[model samples]
Target: MSDLPRLSSSRVPTPFIAFAVLAILSLALAGCDGQAQEEAKPERPVLTIKVHYAPQTPDRSFVGTIRPRIETDVGFRVPGKVAKRLVEVGQVVDVGQPLALLDDADLKLQAEQADAELRAANGVLAQAQAAENRAAELRRKGWSTDAQMDQAKAAAAEARGRVIRAERSVELTKNNLSYATLRADARGVVMATAAEPGQVVASGQGVVRIARVAEKEAVVAVPETLVARAQGGEAHVSLWSEPGKTYAAKLREFAPVADAATRTYLAKFSIPAADDAVKLGMTATLTLAEPASERVARVPLSAVFNQGHGPSVFVADAATGKVELRPVTVKSYETRDAVIADGVKDGENIVALGVHKLDTAQKVRVVSSLSF
Candidate 1:
């Protein structure tokens, strides 16, 4: 009995040994499963993005020209020689300012002649009145015949008619004399001068060109595709000469029809009266604001992947954490971004960086440290 106990008694059961090995294997498997669960977590993708929301405004810019608000062609009212040009080109003038003078020597001579004729007519009228009174007195004293009194009355009536005609001639001459001086009807700057000293101008001939100095306008041509968006909106204006300064203007008018040659619509913007720095014919840039109702998907210019078939972008779904190849139609592109006309919405996130390696339906882990 003492030798048997020392000799390890009876041999252990094979099934029992097998069960012990199986228990150890189960414990090792459990530890491996715990490690796998931790390692299976996904890594996030790195991206930079701007949230898609209602666009604050789509500010579009276009080229334009500076033009005068009001342009006028100054002309003479009567025919005569231009004695002198009182204003020069680019001269600022006020209302009722004399712009030119016509020769009045002939007019003065005519006026003098009319005055002399009026005085002569007055003398004839006085003589006729005296003769008529004398004839009436003689008839009353029974010294003159009725036929003499009738003849004197006829002579007095003819002389009074002559005096009235002479007075009208004098008034007409005075009016013509006053018309010899050409004057401006409004405050403006002279843009052109067509008359000079000793130049003969006919009535209604343009002697100068003037434009209102206080009101300025910007004239721009909008593309036919964008004309509808430009009507009745405010515009931002920048002067070419003064690029740093900007001003606001209101869109006042747009042509109903498009220009035949250029296929663009003509539009005008009313701008504040700029100082002398803003000269006529200076170039300007106009920026028109688009309405907020137009919704569009946009992305950075770099995010777009160019393919022979069409343009596309990389989209990452948050739920699945997978990248997808999405086709997009580009509506328009600006300096740093592009506007997708279709095929996207406001809430979806897109891969902006490292998109070149992405494929459709590929699983990805979003790394928290790299997520933008």
Candidate 2:
């Protein structure tokens, strides 16, 4: 009977042991489940992108030339033959500098003839005065009639008027002779000469072209696509001779019509109070900062994952350190950047590369950040 009690007690202990073993097995299975779940969730190092809405800068490398604002064509004021070309092309001239002379032989002859006429007129006036004085004395002596005295007075007055007219003719001849010489009307550089020595030129005929150096400007031919941007944005100029230096420029004017030969718009930019370094015909380059057509954010191409649905990017939340798939509208694409129109906000971080293999609830460690 004592052995039976002991066997029964042993059997009871076996049930407790079995219960403990079951409890241990359940705890082990729970631990394995927790480990599997942790393994299933991926934690990969990913490259990230931050949303940005920066105004794009337009590239302006158009070739240009420095030119004077006023290019005047100067010519002679009198009709005559060019006796001499005093100034050559590229020669600087001051106002009233003699440029050329006409043949003065005929002018001299006309002056001489005027002088001879004046001398003859004076002699006639003296004879008329002597006759008038003699006639007045005869009238006083009662031997000369009133009609004869009056006629002598009229002749004297006519002779005196002729003398005055002759003097005026002499003055006019002197002025005509002075007009034979062509002179510069303004201070400027002679760009071109049209008349040569001994060439007959009429009045107001263009003999030389003068470029006024008072104000300078940069002239460039802009492509049709860039004309609007050129006018709207700020323009800068740099001379090829002094590549390191730069000059600020303003949009002065633009040609209304396109150039037929070049098929480009001619734009002129004025340099305010430019120094002497900027010379006429100097080669230069023009740069402009253009505004974007639409304000948008830019992202990398690798960050986008379409998968038949609209394009989406995996954006990482800074607070949670977790990634969320965000739906974005791409405005346009570049070689390395994608212009996002509506999907992302500025300053938001996004996955830059390897977006296709990512899960919606995946936790990621940002290895590096990229700016696009």
Q: Best candidate per lDDT, number?
A: 2
* Tens-digit lDDT track of model 2 for 126-155: 999999999999999999999999999999
- Tens-digit per-residue lDDT, 342-361, candidate 1: 76666667777677766664
lDDT of model 2 at position 96: 90
lDDT of 1 at 62: 89
Q: Quote model 2's TM-score.
A: 0.52
TM of each candidate vs. truth: 0.55, 0.52
TM-score of 1: 0.55
Worst 10 residues of 1 by lDDT: 363-372
Q: What C-alpha RMSD separates each model from the true structure?
A: 9.8, 8.8
